[model samples]
Target: MKKRSGAGLRARVGAIFVILAATVAVVDGCNGQNSIVGGACVTGYVACADQCVNTAVDPANCGSCDVVCPSGVACLDGLCGGPVDGSSDGSALGDGSSGDGSAGDGSFGDGGDGGCEPPFNRSSACGACDVVCVAPNSACLADPSGNFVCAPPCTPPLVECENACVDTQTDPLNCGVCGKFCPSNLCANGVCQGATPGDVVVLGHDYSSGAAGSSQAKVLTNAVFIPPSNPLRVLSYEQFADAAAVARVKSLVQSAAFGRTVVFTPSTTSADLASPTLAQSYDVVLVYDQQGGAPANLTTIGASWVTSLSDFAKAGGVIVALDGAAGQGGMPQLLTSAGLLAVGGHQTIPAGTPVAVVAPADRIGAVVASPYGVYNRSVSLQAVEPEGPNVIYVAKQLVNGTPANPVVVHKIVNP
Candidate 1:
């Protein structure tokens, strides 16, 4: 080839540059057949099957070309199954809102608050977020006031202790209160049982011999024997027919002459009887007759109260019912209802009647004075003829020098 002139060389080079520019335009633009002439894609896009696509957000080409996401999943930042932002091409899951079963705000269920599903009332997230309720006997429940709260999963008499429903009155590990373990593991009537012998006191009916009047001291000395180590705690329901009767009992028990330490708690209503926690606090329950000479109605006292009293007795708590306390709707009715007494009813006994101790070997017989005389108006269960293996006829009234009816009866209820 011969050396060409500068003008001719410059004209040829200019024509070649024009042809190269045309070729570049053809590669960058789409061909008429809907395909690129060459592999030339945008800065943030990739070439796939003769097409230029942004694989970062495209569901069909997510992450990499032809890497399609699931039907209800979104492709974000080159990853599948990411939270949707609504700016996506209406092909992703969820409405990108707080609720609407969207994963954007962690509301996959019935959405109440963020980060929790199914209204956030579950035990794992009770009431509010991240509020997990303790388990076993506790749960997330709606209170009476219509608010969600964490409460024990036990009924009235049963309390929650150590993640279990337990009866404090009988449970040795939780006697009277939770975490109050008894060393001897012998819990009776919510009190730790000792090796000392226990006795039951009967405060009903007047014990008199001629003009000696009420032999309260003699009866108490023999019947109500409490060991010095374990003091007697008495809960007296002051609904007696006569105020003097209550005052007499109080004075006799509280006076230093009584010998033992007696803690007397008197109340007008039967509210404490309904609660096992409250009822088990005392060693004895004294039920007195009301002004009408009839005991408090069991129906009015409620079933829960009756049950509590029965449990108290069954757990070794002493019950001293006076005079009319065994009348139509009194302690006798309660005992019958509680299954503590199979047969229980009352009958009026004439004043100044002679009473004799039938079983001298029995505890009540050994204590009660023989040939006992009744001073004030007294009542007896002799007419009803209360009978059972636990029943003990300590004394009986003598009518015309013969044993007529049972005057003083004792029922032995084993715990």
Candidate 2:
């Protein structure tokens, strides 16, 4: 090409630059239409089918311009499947989502907290950051394979030491305490040669004592024993009417309170039940009911039994109402009214179905072994709002899968 004059060359170069600019715009603008990339698409608008449209509140183009939300779910203020609350400030999931469902900085190993702790490391966090090592019986420690996990200490006399759950009460290799070898083959009561044979007062009772002279005492006694907590006697009171109640009484008698029972009275007409001495003597009262009603005049024997129990509870005596007791008359009403318990109701779960036992941070799980158990019938009481904030909720709800209502609760009354 021949050299041109300065002005002519400059004019031709400017024209070529203009042409290139136009061509570049068309090439990068998504087939000459609006695109999510570059200046063609603006914020507060989405690029869909050659157009930039406001998807923030559009029913047809919901969260994204192309997303036509279903009629069943609403498209609300740029959020899909949310109610039209008339405000738009919350962040939402975008189509550019990671398959794992987490959008922010993702570096934590499988289900691990953000560089905080491993999933199975019980000492730091177990299962997840939110789920920690729990229950007095359980502790965070390593197993035989050396992986961190949450595990229960070996039964009673046994203890956890040197990465193992060892029976310190009997182990010769680690007798009395861990690593304390015994000279003889005897390790008793966790001490070398300290074995002392004594009567184990494992006690329990059935709520219903069948037909006047009949009994299910053998069955009650034969069934697994519930360990009694001594020096804190529990009065296992039951009616003679309910088979279910009686069956549950068999279970209740195993509570720590049972070991404290000053007297054993299952009959509805038991004089001790109404005795003021009973309230003064015992630390706890476990009431098991079948018909949801007291025996004739039982509530009014000398002193109103209901009044006595209420006073006892008010005076720091723990009153535990067992199966069907929620449905029991005035007593339950008093308890419910006081906000010590959720109100009366019952739900019979399907046979063999395990109800999820929600245990809070307390000694509850230690007393009740399993976090889940199969109960044919459970006391389902609708929770009532408490008068004051003095009420302590032990467990919110028991559920097979879906939570129905509150089950276990506690409260210490004030004068």
Candidate 3:
């Protein structure tokens, strides 16, 4: 409180300065104990709890000193786990490094080129894609309805218009011309069908026959009509052995390399079967029609005939029959008698008024020639025995064109 001399004041001020220096040294020592030396800031060396640290390169904590790693590894957050192997160099299984497929192996993910298009499959280029059918037959023209059909110039004649071929026969826009579309209403297939009166042209005419008019019907080089048995012979129960029917069958054999004939037999005898033998002698018989119409006596066609027919068909001759006309009775009984399983038989298309006709697109059958009576023409085929291969040609308005509904049904015996 009193003012001292200059010397005394000097001494007192020096002492106060020393005390302040000593206090600073003690505070610094305590701080040093909790701090790190160089970069070894970790426990057991120079560290504190409740704080972040890097055990790596920490001399006091070499490998993992209190959650600290060695120098080689970096301290990620506060853990000293292990050294990171950053060498993902082209050795992984699904890394796309194999240069084959995608970045995934089929075991774990997708595989292959991811498609079945061109260069992928040995067959179709525009075929299945990604295991599913895709743009098939790029050569075919697609209808507006998304139906892809063969275009013009149907290759390998007789092939129907499909994905690879366009049937120019019935194409009104391209009749007889490859890719050439026929005018409106022009029917075409391999050949034209449904010619109007006098529309058909004969190769030769015979005016010599004064009363015989033309004395000749239009003939097709590749086509032949398949006629049924003459509806006569009610007493003998034998199919009418007409020379015309026989000659017609022979003509069919001569024309087609492969032929099918269904000959109705009322009474089976060695004589009645002679024609079928002749029919089979020349061409491969696809079918033999032995089912006669309602016979006067259904039970009299000797068992030998039935046996022969069955044997012949079993040897690959196609045998077709009506509902109950094949073996002295209906299909059920006839098939049993034939020693064959009746796979398919008598099912009739209920007789309906003729609505329209459908023709096979094959070269051998009737086809659309002209567009005159092509669409929605009412017509019907009387199916007395329904169980067979129901087939009909589209020809309602004219005798030349085929009818819509199936006119013929070739039932296959399952056995």
Candidate 4:
């Protein structure tokens, strides 16, 4: 009797399991429609990018995802044409894969600092008020297309070098880093020293993709001064800072090899910055003008670029940095990685902010024109002070007569 009862209970449990399975299938919708409770959009809204915004009314997300409206417009219906047009018609059209995710332009006040702003709203200067438009005609225009000038439009043979058109075959004022005059020696191949065709490899915008603002267009056209014998190769990118870094590297070469064999390459990405074989290939790696303000590729940094750059430095590869592009704002991470930026060493000041001279007899003082105007292009000013024993006060400027207010400094990477 006991055995019979156990068998009956097992049969009953199996029957219950089958019924539950059927109910679950019905709940999930077998006919292609989802099970809706309390309406699909009104209360049970699907999660979109960046915020908990209602895509039906959010301007950033008019109908589809990332389909943002202009600054003064609002999202209506399944489209965003002008100002507010029509209603949503009580429908939820999502990208289908819905849930809380990272910030996208799904709408305003959704999350992650109000998601995305309109393209024309560079008034906030990148929409975050981080960038300040100092130039008069440069009103933060959102370069609508890619077809823009990448190189200086100088007629071939008559190259435009340093704001003036000159023939590379014979030009001394703009030879190498410009003003490297030699009254006695003949100018050969733009070099005041040797005219022989040396290995001149340039990682620059001249050979880069003609993308608007990818690499600094000036850096490439200036290559004319590098001489005709050296091979010019560009390692460039589409972002401004990344491209500027490439220019910075080139400048480093210019500083060292002003009249020597000018071989240079710039890093357009973190991968380029941290190339494993970079130290082997290049004699000196210049790091400056890294990322700039109002950059597009902020979070897309490579993990090993800093390490790679540091390894190159430690391996005796020379690194020359002019501005804080590689020292502070642009590639502050590199400074930190190379042990240059310390707890109280990094200093920052506003652009054009006047500071008293502390070390006018130093190297920095020898180069700069005035105490003010340290950083003119960037809205925020940043710099790293000298650190470690080898850290030297090339030049120091003070804001309020204090030792901590150093404006110009140089820190050794390894020592």
Best by TM-score: 1
* Per-residue C-alpha lDDT of model 2 across residues 21-75, encoded as one tens digit per residue: 4224323322323322112233344556645444643456776767886654444
Model 3's alpha-carbon lDDT is 0.29
Number of the candidate with higher TM-score, 1 or 2:
1
Point out where model 2 deviates above 4 Å.
1-232, 240-263, 270-274, 292-303, 325-344, 352-354, 367-371, 385-389, 396-402
lDDT of 4 by residue, 176-196 (tens): 333334333455665454322
Model 3 clash count equals: 51
Order of quality (TM-score): 1, 2, 4, 3
TM-score list, all predictions: 0.46, 0.35, 0.24, 0.33
In what order do the candidates fall by lDDT, top score first? 1, 2, 4, 3
Of the two candidates 2 and 4, the one with more favorable lDDT, higher being better, is 2
Please, what is the whole-model Cα lDDT of each candidate in the order they appear? 0.52, 0.41, 0.29, 0.37
lDDT of 1 by residue, 103-180 (tens): 222211222223223353555545443344564414767768764555656776888875688998888777776655
Please list the residue runs of candidate 4 whose C-alpha ends up more than 4 Å from where it truly belongs after superposition. Answer: 1-258, 292-303, 321-330, 337-340, 343-351, 355-372, 378-386, 401-404
Please list all clashing residue pairs in model 1, or write none if there are none. none
Q: What is the C-alpha RMSD, rounded to one decimal, of candidate 2? A: 23.9
Whole-model lDDT for model 1 versus the true structure?
Answer: 0.52
Instruction: For candidate 4, report its TM-score.
Output: 0.33
Better of 1 and 3 by lDDT: 1
